[model samples]
Target: MRRLLPRNSLRSRLLGDLWKPLFCLLLLGAVAVFFLARHIGSSVYDRWLYDSAMTLAEQVRVEDGKAVLDLPKQAVEMFEWDQVDRIFSDVRSRRYGLIFRNSDLPPPPEELQPGQSRIFPHWVKGHAARVVAVAVPNPADPADVLVIQVAETMLKRNTLATDILVLVVPVLVVLALLVGIVVWRAVATGVRAVDQVVERLDSYGPDRLLPVGEITNAPAEVRPLLNAINQLIRRLSDLQDTQRRFIANAAHQLRTPLATLQVQTERALREPDAARHGQALSRVLKAVTRSRHLAHQLLMLARSEQSGEKALQMQEVDLAVLARDELERWIDSALQQHVDIGYDGPESGVEVYGEPVLLRELIGNLVDNAIRYGSVRDDGRRGGAVTLRLQVQPIMLVVEDDGPGIPPSERTLVLERFYRRRGAGGQGCGLGLSIAREIAQRHGARLVITDPPQGMGARVEIRFAR
Candidate 1:
């Protein structure tokens, strides 16, 4: 069942709630003022009534020791000015008797005592009155009593109070509304700086890392966030500049050897004698091949450095299968060189996620590097075979050549780009291990160089992350 409620309810929106409390306070203030004015006016009027009563008492004479009044007409006329009604009574022999009375309404209850006052709504006779009555000793005899009662109709007091409220309430309300509007405008203006900052950020891009312009009227709270963003932009801009310079320098340095090899190949093609031409052409082709391999490796290294971490399309692939396929492709080349190439892995799949092209390049480089470097030995005559192994359970790719192994002291140096070992005779630009290391890093894997288990040759292992 729905419950009944008062006519005035307080539940409302923010502004509505605010205004109600203020309006209530204003209304209470207005009521207080109305009552205060009435009290002061009534006090003045009561003094006048008492004075009239005193004057009438003064006029009393003890003719036969009884009270007789010689009340003046002017004193009665004074009550009419304030619309005040009066009632006069004479007391003799301790009994009350009505003397002269003038009122626009019926008198109050007879139980009313002199010098006592009461205020109530008087709906009878179509009007309300505030009444006061007083009794005093007859001044002429002190044995007779004279009472004076005064009442003012409340209609005039109510009209005056209504007029005051009509004038004051609108003024207060208008003042409150103006205050609210000013506060809202101030708040909006304060937050405008944050909007400008957001607009600047919306237009920003990777290339444009410039600091956002300072907002002139930004709020204190948002300034720190803006400063941090500006600092981040500056740091990224510095890093990008460094990477661009590195790519440029690496490209310039690698192009020189490539051009030299191209010129040598053209010179060798122009030789006249068939035998000499064939030998020179073969040498030129070997140089050209080495140059081409170096150029490709350099390009791959540059891509790895410049592309950040997103260059590879990673997916779950079986490294064991990849090793088998790579070995098949290189088997004919190994046969021509009178070398043995083989792969070893379990039948089950060894799954790993990485860019397939880069992973192929990585494994191919390791095997090619081992074969090329391990083909010649201290005793010469191609000592032993090369083996490509894919260990599935741990996901490791191992390339080992049974040629004279690398010295333990030079293992780390061999992985640096273009750093060929002193006694290692091969037509390589020394980028195989470097390129392999880069591809391994891209896949969150590691390339480690160590002596093979039999201690005959170097073993290169690419270990994938678990």
Candidate 2:
């Protein structure tokens, strides 16, 4: 039902918001002009009425011991003559009740003294009239005075007011129309600018994702939105590049192990002698195990790379216990490599807040990297020592080994995915240190690589904030 209604655009809302108040202001101005015109017209006509009353006062006199008007019937008719109005006159004295009158005009409510005059409005026979009253001294008796009043209907005043309104109203309407057109055009131009911005956005594709160019003529209000959109575009571009690199590297790392496994399996099947057949099978099993371990590490690296807040299941983890358990699991591998590995931490638990599974992965990767790369000598013999050490009070964990230590300049590079040292011996895919670093970051811990305290060995330390 709501969809059936016309949608309001920016232009319509802007015009509506501007026009409603303008229309009311114009209407109020017209009404004020009309009343002002009426008032001015009344003032001009009132002076004429007062002059007519003074002329009547000239004809008043004392005759036969009484106040009388000496105006003849012809003069009386001439005094009352008007083209578009009816006129009324009344002459009265305080000593006498009534002196002379042309029509039945009511006397004024207020008293009038000699040499005084007054003009006021009154209603006459259901029509509006202007009344002017004047007082004059009687010629026969100076003590007594005569009051003469003249009144005329408001026909001329009404005509003048109507003519003024007719002249002014059309001009006001034309001015209002001109203002509306200007406002409408201004609003449309602003909306068109916004439309251009939207069109620019729609032109973008995945491969063509470039930041928007700056528009010199754009409104000030739109600049902040453009800046935010540009920031988002940059972030998306970086993510896209990272994804491309990860896919390429993963494929390259898997190809070598997969090819080895296939070759060993074929060689095992082609062996005729029973003893040689068992030896080929053993190599085949070793290849399969190495490939499986690579695949698992790749999965672990991917899991550690995720940065979503909800993916981490955090709890209080005992670092000492976790290290001891993981060390026990790697005992057989260390023995096979002819390397001595052990844990050196408190017997009791030292708890920290983290995800237990990720923490175990972090510790396992550190141990695995040490055992793989550190179990070698200059003579090509596979024998060395790796130790997992823990401390409290600004908690720290250290994995140290007695082997050729990493170069100071390449310490940072080793933390990158698939970055291996030159001439390093092992079946390592070079993801162990990278996975350890990622998990350490997720747990809000700092991982640093430096020389161990005793002398010639690599020391990797994790410092927890708590």
- Model 2 per-residue lDDT tens digits across residues 1-466: 2311344866666777788999998999888878889899988888888888887787676668777887878887798888999999898777666788877777754568888988888887777888888888877677877888898999988888889988999999999999988877776665665667678879987576677768656677767877887777777766666566667878998899889988988988999999999999999888888888789888887677554223587899888888898889899999999989988889657999999889999999989989888987768889899999998877998999988889999999999888989987777888999889888999999999999998898999999987
Candidate 1 regions exceeding 4 Å error are 1-256, 307-312, 379-383
Worst 10 residues of 2 by lDDT: 1-10
> What local lDDT does model 2 show for residue 453?
90
Residue 84, model 1, lDDT: 35
Candidate 2 has a TM-score of 0.73
Could you give candidate 1's per-residue lDDT for residues 199-312 as a string of tens digits?
A: 887888757767887988887876997898788777777667757765674676558766776776777778787888788778777777776777777777766655443446
Q: What is the lDDT of residue 7 in candidate 1?
A: 34
- Candidate 1 vs. true structure, TM-score: 0.55
- Local accuracy by lDDT, each model: 0.67, 0.83
Query: TM-score of each candidate?
Result: 0.55, 0.73
For every model in order, what is the number of clashing pairs? Answer: 0, 0
